[model samples]
Target: MTTSLTIAVKRIHDAAAASDGARFLVDRLWPRGVSREKAALAAWLKPLSPSDALRKRYHGETADSDEAWDAFRLDYFEELDAGGEEAKAALFTLDAAAKVGPVTLLYAAKSAERNNALALREWLERRTR
Candidate 1:
Protein backbone atom coordinates (compact mmCIF):
# COMPACT_ATOMS: atom_id res chain seq x y z
CA MET A 1 0.00 0.00 0.00
CA THR A 2 1.17 3.56 -0.71
CA THR A 3 1.08 6.21 1.99
CA SER A 4 0.84 9.95 1.56
CA LEU A 5 3.49 12.03 3.33
CA THR A 6 3.30 15.55 4.68
CA ILE A 7 6.82 16.97 4.47
CA ALA A 8 7.44 20.48 5.72
CA VAL A 9 10.68 22.41 5.92
CA LYS A 10 11.66 24.72 8.75
CA ARG A 11 14.73 26.36 10.16
CA ILE A 12 16.40 24.56 13.03
CA HIS A 13 16.75 27.79 14.99
CA ASP A 14 13.04 28.40 14.98
CA ALA A 15 10.79 27.38 17.84
CA ALA A 16 9.31 23.95 17.53
CA ALA A 17 5.58 23.49 17.68
CA ALA A 18 3.30 20.50 18.10
CA SER A 19 2.21 21.01 14.50
CA ASP A 20 5.78 20.36 13.43
CA GLY A 21 5.15 16.71 14.12
CA ALA A 22 8.17 14.42 13.86
CA ARG A 23 11.12 16.79 13.33
CA PHE A 24 14.21 15.53 11.57
CA LEU A 25 17.39 17.58 11.29
CA VAL A 26 18.60 17.24 7.70
CA ASP A 27 21.87 19.10 8.12
CA ARG A 28 25.00 16.98 8.15
CA LEU A 29 26.52 19.15 10.87
CA TRP A 30 24.65 20.34 13.91
CA PRO A 31 23.53 23.94 13.79
CA ARG A 32 25.61 26.41 15.74
CA GLY A 33 24.36 27.51 19.18
CA VAL A 34 21.48 25.02 19.11
CA SER A 35 21.69 22.42 21.83
CA ARG A 36 20.44 18.88 21.39
CA GLU A 37 17.68 19.54 23.88
CA LYS A 38 16.55 22.64 21.99
CA ALA A 39 16.64 20.90 18.61
CA ALA A 40 13.90 18.50 19.77
CA LEU A 41 14.63 16.25 16.87
CA ALA A 42 13.25 12.74 16.47
CA ALA A 43 16.42 11.93 14.55
CA TRP A 44 19.35 13.65 12.82
CA LEU A 45 19.46 12.14 9.34
CA LYS A 46 22.93 13.29 8.31
CA PRO A 47 23.29 10.65 5.64
CA LEU A 48 20.39 12.23 3.78
CA SER A 49 22.21 15.56 3.56
CA PRO A 50 24.37 16.74 0.69
CA SER A 51 27.99 15.65 0.57
CA ASP A 52 30.61 17.88 2.17
CA ALA A 53 32.19 18.75 -1.15
CA LEU A 54 28.90 19.83 -2.70
CA ARG A 55 27.95 21.87 0.35
CA LYS A 56 31.32 23.59 0.45
CA ARG A 57 31.17 24.35 -3.24
CA TYR A 58 27.76 25.90 -2.94
CA HIS A 59 28.78 27.90 0.08
CA GLY A 60 31.74 29.28 -1.82
CA GLU A 61 29.46 30.69 -4.48
CA THR A 62 29.24 34.52 -4.35
CA ALA A 63 25.54 34.73 -4.96
CA ASP A 64 22.45 32.57 -4.76
CA SER A 65 21.88 32.83 -8.47
CA ASP A 66 19.36 30.58 -10.19
CA GLU A 67 22.16 28.91 -12.11
CA ALA A 68 24.02 28.07 -8.92
CA TRP A 69 20.88 26.85 -7.25
CA ASP A 70 20.02 24.67 -10.21
CA ALA A 71 23.49 23.18 -10.28
CA PHE A 72 23.41 22.52 -6.56
CA ARG A 73 20.05 20.81 -6.80
CA LEU A 74 21.08 18.65 -9.74
CA ASP A 75 24.29 17.60 -7.97
CA TYR A 76 22.37 16.92 -4.80
CA PHE A 77 19.85 14.77 -6.65
CA GLU A 78 22.67 12.85 -8.24
CA GLU A 79 24.19 12.23 -4.84
CA LEU A 80 20.88 10.98 -3.51
CA ASP A 81 20.46 8.71 -6.50
CA ALA A 82 23.95 7.23 -6.08
CA GLY A 83 23.85 7.14 -2.28
CA GLY A 84 24.89 3.95 -0.50
CA GLU A 85 23.28 1.78 2.17
CA GLU A 86 23.46 4.33 4.98
CA ALA A 87 21.68 6.94 2.92
CA LYS A 88 19.09 4.38 1.85
CA ALA A 89 18.50 3.42 5.45
CA ALA A 90 18.04 7.05 6.44
CA LEU A 91 15.54 7.61 3.64
CA PHE A 92 13.70 4.43 4.62
CA THR A 93 13.45 5.65 8.17
CA LEU A 94 12.20 9.05 7.02
CA ASP A 95 9.62 7.43 4.74
CA ALA A 96 8.39 5.27 7.61
CA ALA A 97 7.89 8.24 9.91
CA ALA A 98 6.29 10.36 7.18
CA LYS A 99 3.88 7.54 6.39
CA VAL A 100 2.52 7.66 9.92
CA GLY A 101 2.07 11.42 10.19
CA PRO A 102 3.39 14.88 9.30
CA VAL A 103 7.15 15.37 9.20
CA THR A 104 9.22 18.57 9.35
CA LEU A 105 12.68 18.63 7.83
CA LEU A 106 14.84 20.99 9.88
CA TYR A 107 17.81 22.91 8.52
CA ALA A 108 20.15 25.60 9.82
CA ALA A 109 20.67 27.61 6.67
CA LYS A 110 19.93 31.33 6.77
CA SER A 111 18.21 31.20 3.39
CA ALA A 112 14.77 29.67 3.59
CA GLU A 113 14.70 29.49 -0.19
CA ARG A 114 17.91 27.57 -0.97
CA ASN A 115 18.65 24.88 1.55
CA ASN A 116 19.22 21.18 1.50
CA ALA A 117 16.09 20.45 3.51
CA LEU A 118 14.02 22.22 0.90
CA ALA A 119 15.76 20.34 -1.89
CA LEU A 120 15.23 17.10 -0.04
CA ARG A 121 11.56 17.80 0.51
CA GLU A 122 11.18 18.54 -3.21
CA TRP A 123 12.99 15.32 -4.00
CA LEU A 124 10.76 13.31 -1.69
CA GLU A 125 7.62 14.95 -3.03
CA ARG A 126 8.62 14.18 -6.60
CA ARG A 127 9.25 10.52 -5.80
CA THR A 128 5.90 10.17 -4.01
CA ARG A 129 4.10 11.49 -7.10
Candidate 2:
Protein backbone atom coordinates (compact mmCIF):
# COMPACT_ATOMS: atom_id res chain seq x y z
CA MET A 1 0.00 0.00 0.00
CA THR A 2 1.23 3.56 -0.81
CA THR A 3 0.13 6.54 1.29
CA SER A 4 1.26 10.08 2.03
CA LEU A 5 0.41 12.72 4.68
CA THR A 6 -0.42 16.35 4.18
CA ILE A 7 -1.74 19.23 6.35
CA ALA A 8 -3.62 21.58 4.05
CA VAL A 9 -7.35 21.89 4.70
CA LYS A 10 -8.15 22.11 0.99
CA ARG A 11 -5.94 19.12 0.26
CA ILE A 12 -7.93 17.14 2.80
CA HIS A 13 -11.18 17.89 0.99
CA ASP A 14 -9.57 17.01 -2.29
CA ALA A 15 -8.21 13.72 -0.95
CA ALA A 16 -11.56 12.73 0.50
CA ALA A 17 -13.19 13.34 -2.83
CA ALA A 18 -10.90 11.06 -4.79
CA SER A 19 -11.82 7.44 -5.50
CA ASP A 20 -10.92 4.83 -2.85
CA GLY A 21 -10.61 7.61 -0.28
CA ALA A 22 -11.29 7.82 3.44
CA ARG A 23 -10.77 10.65 5.92
CA PHE A 24 -9.94 9.93 9.56
CA LEU A 25 -9.80 12.75 12.09
CA VAL A 26 -7.15 11.72 14.57
CA ASP A 27 -7.84 14.09 17.40
CA ARG A 28 -9.07 13.48 20.93
CA LEU A 29 -11.20 16.60 20.95
CA TRP A 30 -13.45 17.63 18.13
CA PRO A 31 -12.37 20.81 16.41
CA ARG A 32 -14.30 23.78 17.64
CA GLY A 33 -17.01 25.15 15.31
CA VAL A 34 -16.87 22.30 12.80
CA SER A 35 -19.98 20.14 12.71
CA ARG A 36 -19.92 16.43 11.97
CA GLU A 37 -21.78 16.99 8.73
CA LYS A 38 -19.58 19.95 7.79
CA ALA A 39 -16.42 18.00 8.59
CA ALA A 40 -17.52 15.22 6.25
CA LEU A 41 -15.21 12.75 7.92
CA ALA A 42 -15.55 9.03 7.44
CA ALA A 43 -14.32 8.47 11.00
CA TRP A 44 -13.12 10.38 14.05
CA LEU A 45 -10.21 8.33 15.31
CA LYS A 46 -9.91 9.98 18.70
CA PRO A 47 -8.41 6.81 20.08
CA LEU A 48 -5.40 7.62 17.92
CA SER A 49 -4.67 10.93 19.63
CA PRO A 50 -2.00 11.25 22.26
CA SER A 51 -3.09 10.76 25.86
CA ASP A 52 -4.09 13.85 27.84
CA ALA A 53 -0.93 13.79 29.91
CA LEU A 54 1.21 13.40 26.84
CA ARG A 55 -0.65 16.07 24.99
CA LYS A 56 -0.20 18.51 27.82
CA ARG A 57 3.46 17.66 28.01
CA TYR A 58 4.27 17.73 24.34
CA HIS A 59 2.02 20.40 22.95
CA GLY A 60 4.02 23.52 22.08
CA GLU A 61 7.18 21.92 23.36
CA THR A 62 10.21 21.41 21.14
CA ALA A 63 11.81 19.06 23.68
CA ASP A 64 9.56 16.25 22.45
CA SER A 65 11.79 13.81 20.56
CA ASP A 66 12.41 10.14 19.79
CA GLU A 67 12.76 9.32 23.47
CA ALA A 68 9.46 11.05 24.00
CA TRP A 69 7.97 8.60 21.54
CA ASP A 70 9.37 5.70 23.52
CA ALA A 71 7.81 7.08 26.67
CA PHE A 72 4.60 7.55 24.71
CA ARG A 73 4.62 3.99 23.43
CA LEU A 74 4.57 2.77 27.01
CA ASP A 75 1.86 5.17 28.14
CA TYR A 76 -0.04 5.21 24.86
CA PHE A 77 -0.54 1.47 24.52
CA GLU A 78 -4.16 1.41 25.59
CA GLU A 79 -5.18 4.27 23.32
CA LEU A 80 -2.85 3.89 20.36
CA ASP A 81 -1.41 0.40 20.30
CA ALA A 82 -4.73 -1.23 21.09
CA GLY A 83 -7.54 1.08 20.04
CA GLY A 84 -5.56 2.91 17.38
CA GLU A 85 -4.37 -0.33 15.82
CA GLU A 86 -7.95 -1.26 15.10
CA ALA A 87 -8.69 2.22 13.76
CA LYS A 88 -5.53 2.12 11.64
CA ALA A 89 -6.44 -1.31 10.35
CA ALA A 90 -9.80 0.00 9.29
CA LEU A 91 -8.12 2.96 7.59
CA PHE A 92 -5.83 0.58 5.75
CA THR A 93 -8.83 -1.36 4.61
CA LEU A 94 -10.05 1.91 3.19
CA ASP A 95 -6.60 2.45 1.68
CA ALA A 96 -6.65 -0.95 0.01
CA ALA A 97 -9.97 -0.03 -1.46
CA ALA A 98 -8.64 3.41 -2.43
CA LYS A 99 -6.20 2.50 -5.16
CA VAL A 100 -6.50 5.90 -6.78
CA GLY A 101 -6.05 8.67 -4.18
CA PRO A 102 -4.40 9.28 -0.84
CA VAL A 103 -6.10 8.51 2.48
CA THR A 104 -6.19 11.83 4.33
CA LEU A 105 -5.58 11.90 8.09
CA LEU A 106 -7.08 15.10 9.41
CA TYR A 107 -6.73 16.95 12.71
CA ALA A 108 -8.32 19.93 14.44
CA ALA A 109 -5.39 21.77 15.99
CA LYS A 110 -4.33 25.38 15.87
CA SER A 111 -0.66 24.53 15.98
CA ALA A 112 -0.04 23.26 12.47
CA GLU A 113 3.67 22.64 13.02
CA ARG A 114 3.47 20.76 16.33
CA ASN A 115 0.43 18.58 16.68
CA ASN A 116 -0.59 14.96 17.04
CA ALA A 117 -1.19 14.74 13.29
CA LEU A 118 2.48 15.33 12.50
CA ALA A 119 3.61 12.78 15.04
CA LEU A 120 1.04 10.25 13.94
CA ARG A 121 1.94 10.85 10.31
CA GLU A 122 5.62 10.36 11.13
CA TRP A 123 4.91 7.13 12.95
CA LEU A 124 2.71 5.74 10.21
CA GLU A 125 5.08 6.79 7.41
CA ARG A 126 8.03 5.17 9.12
CA ARG A 127 6.12 1.95 9.61
CA THR A 128 4.77 1.97 6.08
CA ARG A 129 8.26 2.59 4.72
User: What number of clashing residue pairs does each candidate have, in the order they appear?
Assistant: 0, 1
lDDT of 1 by residue, 32-70 (tens): 999999999999999999999999999999538999999
Alpha-carbon RMSD, each predicted model = 1.4, 5.1
Q: Each model's TM-score?
A: 0.95, 0.61
Backbone clash pairs in model 1 (N, Cα, C under 3 Å; residues 3+ apart or in different chains), count? 0
lDDT of 2 by residue, 10-43 (tens): 2222334544246777777777777677667777
lDDT of 2: 0.59
Summing lDDT over every window of 10 consecutive residues in candidate 1, give the lowest-scoring window: 1-10
What TM value does model 2 have? 0.61
Pairs with backbone N, CA or C atoms under 3 Å apart (clashes), candidate 1: none
